[model samples]
Target: MPLDQIPDEKEMSFLDHLEELRWHIIRSLIAIVVIAIAAFAMKDFVIGTVILGPSRTDFWTYQKLCQLADLIGTPALCIDSLTFELVSRKLSSQFMTHVSVSFVVGLVLGFPYLFWEIWRFIKPGLRPQERKASRGATFSVSVLFMMGVLFGYFMIAPISVRFFSTYQVDPSLQNLFDLSSYINTVTLIIFGCGILFQLPVIVYFLTKAGIVSSALMKAYRKHSIIVILILGAIVTPPDPFSQILIALPLMMLYQFSIVIAKRIEKREARQNKES
Candidate 1:
């Protein structure tokens, strides 16, 4: 439908808007389910390699850590082995893992399409100027999500797994992890990082909406660093090395977000002056 033909907020009845929204949501769900079926079909590769890759010493994260340690002369950065065994104690645990993993895969694979569906729904409600302003949002969001997912898988998740696997209260103690717990760790890492990586995009939108500004971000810079460091400590190992590892990248992202906000502010100022 053309912009003039599209129903305005007051012109459309609530139920009419709801009906349109329902279709959009249904289409998005269908896309995810289809992708999930494909993921289920590739169960062997997904479970054996993609899901379990972080538990192996030869994983990319370990190799990178080893190289960094060698360069810096840090012996503790070594990851010799993943000491824990992942076991399913309940009869239904394995089946649950399969379902959970498939759903996660679906979400990751279908995210861009899902967002596009969302954009389609909202575009009709936006002004031409607003739509034009958001032209690059979809691409940027997709790229950021993928980068975050890879970072979680290859950097944050491995360090976390290695740290927990080797952590012991006593010499007699051994770590035998549950399948559900392991899946939770991996999926949570991927999704959490993916969402966190949207900081710059979020700032851009908030700036567009006039809810936040670059000067505000600048004022909170110190607090943001403290919060980032705290989050890094929570997610990564107890060691300062791992905490710093996570915090540094996040700090860089925060700085980037500030820069984006500054540009948006400058653009808005220019438009205001022109008017």
Candidate 2:
């Protein structure tokens, strides 16, 4: 259909909007499946190198920690080994896990395109100024997501895995973990961080909608610190150092969100004055 022939959001009925949204969702799913198929083909590398990297003692994070330990003359940070094992109990557990992991990898890799499709569906409903204001939203969101994933994979996942794999409740028992559980822990932390890293983007939209202000965020700084510390404890190992490491970045992100909100407020004020 020509752009002129198609009805605007105001002219379209509720069912028409649903129909449009359905198509958008279908396209996004198709993109994910295509990418997932490719990921499945490279399962060996993805699963062996990427997914299971944190489980090994010689992993980059452990290596870095060892170096830091040497520099500081503290042997506590040096992790010589991971004292745990992964086993699959179900008949089809491995196969099913491979399939699920491929799909998740596809979703993470194709997030930018997925958001593009969603943005296309939403753009027509927005005013010209709104569209202009949201320019680069997809890129900004994608960058933040990737950064969070890397942080989780490189820093958070390894630390958590090390702590859990080594900490034994009893000396007589061995730490044996299910393969599915291990994968879930790794991916959950990765995707959770990826989503959490979008704090500034979330604040941007809220600020744009006049639902949030920088002053409010500033006033709530102390409360946010407490929340961040709790979140750090939840995501990280039960150690003060690990919790502080996680909380530091989150605190920075919160401060950055306040800056974003302030910029938006200033821009709106300037626009108002000009109008």
Candidate 3:
């Protein structure tokens, strides 16, 4: 789409776009702040229950692992216990932790609305066909992001917490974890996975824009596997089981992205032939 053909006038200066972006940022921030206030109000439930759920060995993940161990005849899968002491060293640590954690929780919950606001800002610049072509973008992005967030919180976060809490250099060294550190790790994993899981949606757009194709993705399958494994290793613990667990889902997402790209290509081709 050319500048003159866009809904916004071609005569509008770059400063005009900047001004529009400022409003978008303001709206996004307001939404986050409102949600943060709600999160803070639900202090006990959000902090004591949801945020710290994985800290206990009786979390659903541990129970599932135990059940899997029984079924597979692998005692190693049964997590009996995790040892770690959560502590606050500084006076302001707890207060800061509460505020920051609430903010992060707010952001996670408000992600869809945030993205919607972004879409609203960008949609004005898009041609009618372009907007139509990207229909359901917000819904698909939200669902994928939330799914990834849940996976990280329920699966990856618990596994990481269990592994790190149980790891020890020596019998004499006590495992004392800082509250801030723990929350940071959990938040990073949740948000990271959420962003990474947009692979399929990203591929759709990239293919539509003619930046990449399904054929390219198919040709690089082996290389993609190596990259996926490397990504898994970067995100997960050094253990092969953990790496493979992360890699498998990533590879599946890659394959799914290829399919999405191919569908987009075929659809575009059909539309062009009709035209």
Who wins the lDDT comparison?
A: 2
In TM-score terms, candidate 3 sits at 0.91
TM-scores of the candidates in the order shown: 0.91, 0.92, 0.91
Off by over 4 Å in 1: 1-10, 68-75, 230-243
lDDT of each: 0.84, 0.87, 0.85
Candidate 2 shows a clash count of: 0
Candidate 2, which segments miss by more than 4 Å at Cα?
A: 1-10, 233-242
| Candidates ranked, most accurate by lDDT first | 2, 3, 1
In candidate 2, which residue pairs get closer than 3 Å at backbone N, Cα or C atoms, i.e. clash?
none
TM-score computed on alpha carbons, candidate 2: 0.92
| lDDT tens per residue, model 3, 71-152 | 9999998887888989999999999988998899879888999998788778777777889889999999999999889988
Q: Give the Cα-based TM-score of candidate 1 against the true structure.
A: 0.91
Q: Which number leads on TM-score?
A: 2
lDDT of 2 by residue, 1-275 (tens): 32223756448778877888888788899999999999899987889888988988878999999999999999998988899999999999999999999999999998888998888888877888888999999999999999989998998898889878878778999998999999988898888788878889999999999998999999999999999888877766677766787788899999999999999999899989999
lDDT of 1 at 120: 80
